[model samples]
Target: MRVAIVGAGLMGAQIGCEYALGGHEVRLHARDLRRAQQRVDEGFALVDRHALFTADEVRAAAARVSTAADPGDAASGADLLVESLPEDLELKTAVLRAALAEAPEAHVATNTSSLSIAAIGEAIGSPERTVGTHYLNPPLLMPPVEVIGGERTAPETVELARKTLIALGKLPVVVRRDVPGFVWNRLQFALVRECAWLVEHGVASAEDVDVVMREGLARRWRRVGPLRAVALGGIDTWNRSGRGIVPDLSNARELPDLATVAITEGNVSDDAGARDAALARELREERALGAAR
Candidate 1:
C-alpha cells in the first residue's frame, strides 16, 4: 500500500510511521521536509525504545518513509491520501482538492479532531471519496481509530478504510452517524466538562480529579469499560443515582474558563519534552499490560 500523508507534524508523522511499520510505503509531505523526516525518525526511535518491534523491523520501517515537497508529490500514485493538517476547513479543502487531483482514484481520509466530514466533502466537491478518520493523539499507541463516513460517502470507501486501518493493526470503529467529535472526543469532553465544573465550584482540585481518574475510573474502565462497569455495578442503582446527578452536571454552552485559568493561575507544565517522555512511559506500560492479558 502506498500512503500519502499531508502535514508531517505530530499526528501526521506518527500516523505515517504506523503505516510504514505496517509494511506500507509512506510519503510525508510538508513545507519543512527536513523537520518532517526528523519527526519520522523520532517516531521510529520511540517504537524501538518501547521494543514494540525488533531492531531490524524498526530499521526497515524507518527506511520505508520518505519526504515529499508538496501534496501532489506525496499523493502521486498513492492508494490513500490522509490530510493531517490544521483544523481549518478552507485550508484542508484546498489541500485535498490539489492532492486528490493528483491521485483521483485514491481514498481520502481527513484527520480532523472536531470537524464535519460532510461539510469538508461539500467544500472539496468529492463527497463520495471523503471520510473522517479521527486518529487519537499518539496514533501508534492508540488502537481505536474512528472511521466516519459522510452522507454521500460510498459504502465501498468506508469498507476500504476499515480494511486498511485493520491492516495497520488498529481497531476501526465505524460511526454510523456523522456527529461532531465522533465517539472518543464526545465521551472525553463530557467527562472533562464535569471535571472542570467540579473545579470551578470548589468541589475538587484538578489534582484530585486526576487522582480519581488515574486511581479509580481509568483502572476500572480498563478492566470492564464504562458500559460494562456500570452493568457490573447494577444499572438500576446507576439509573436512580443519575436522576439527581445528571441534572446537576455542567451544561455550559460557551467554552469553560477552567483551562484558561489553569494555564494562567495554576502551575501547569509547559515542558513538552518531559510530558512526551512521561506519556511514552505510560504507553509502554499500557502495551505491556495488554500483552499480558
Candidate 2:
C-alpha cells in the first residue's frame, strides 16, 4: 500500500516508519522538509533500537519511505492519506482538502487525539472517506489504534481503517460513534483527573500516585480490563465497595491547581522517557512472541 502522511513531526515521522515497517510505501509531507527528514531518520533509528525488525529489514523499510515537497505531492497515487497535524481544526481541514484533491480516492484518516472526526469530515467535505485513526503516543510502538467513524463516514471507510491497521500488526478498536476523545482518551483523562485531584488534596503525592499505577493497578489491568477484573473479584463486592468511592471521585470541571502547576513547570523526567521506551520495546517483543505461539 502507498501511504501519504501529511505531517512530518514526531507523530507523523513515527507513523510513516510504522507503515514502512509494515511493508507499505510511505510519503511524508511537511513545510520543513529538512527537519522532517531528520525526524524520519530518527524514527527509523528508534525502530531499529526496538528490534522490531532485523537490520536488513530495517534498511528495506527505511528505503520504502520518501519525503514529498507538498501535500499534493505526498498524496499523489497514494492508497491512504494520514493527517497528523496539531489539534487545530482549520489547519487539519486545509491540509486534508489539499491532499484529498490529489488523491481523491484514497482513504482519509486523522491522528486526532481529542478533536471530533465528524467536524473534520464536514470541514473537508468528504465525509465518506474521512475516519479517525487515533494512534497512541509513540505511534510506532503502540499497538492500539482507535478507529473512529464520523457521522457521514461510510461503513467501508471504517472497515478500511480497521483492515489497514491490522495489516500493520496493530490492534484496531472501532469506535461506534464519533464522540470527542472517543474511548481511550475518555478513560485516560478520567484517571488523570482523579490522580490530579488526589495529589492536589494531599491525599497522595504525585510520585505515590505513579507508584500505585506502576505497582498495583497496571499489573492487574494490563491483562484484565477493569470490568473483567471486577467481575473476577465478584461484582457484588465491587458494587458494595466501589459504590461509595464513586461519589467521592473527582468531578471538578476545572483543571486542578496541581495539574496546572505541573504543566507550567514543564518538569519532564528524562529517565521516565527512557524507561517508557524500554518498556514499550519489551512489551512489543512479548506480543510478537505471543503471536508466534
> Which candidate wins on TM-score?
2
Best by lDDT: 2
Model 2: ten consecutive residues of lowest lDDT: 258-267
Those runs of model 2 whose alpha carbons end farther than 4 Å from true positions after fitting are: 257-269
Error in Å for residue 239 of model 1:
1.2
lDDT of each: 0.86, 0.88
- lDDT string, candidate 1, 1-293, tens digits: 89999889989999999999999999988999999988998888878876777899999998899998889999999999988999999999888888888998888898998999999988988889889888987787777899999999999989989998988878899999889888998998888888887787898888788789878998788778888878898999999999998888899875586654252543435554465566667666776897899
Candidate 2 residues 211-263, lDDT tens each? 89878999889889898998899989999988888888889886765544243
Provide backbone clash counts, one per model. 0, 0
All predictions: root-mean-square deviation over Cα?
2.7, 2.0
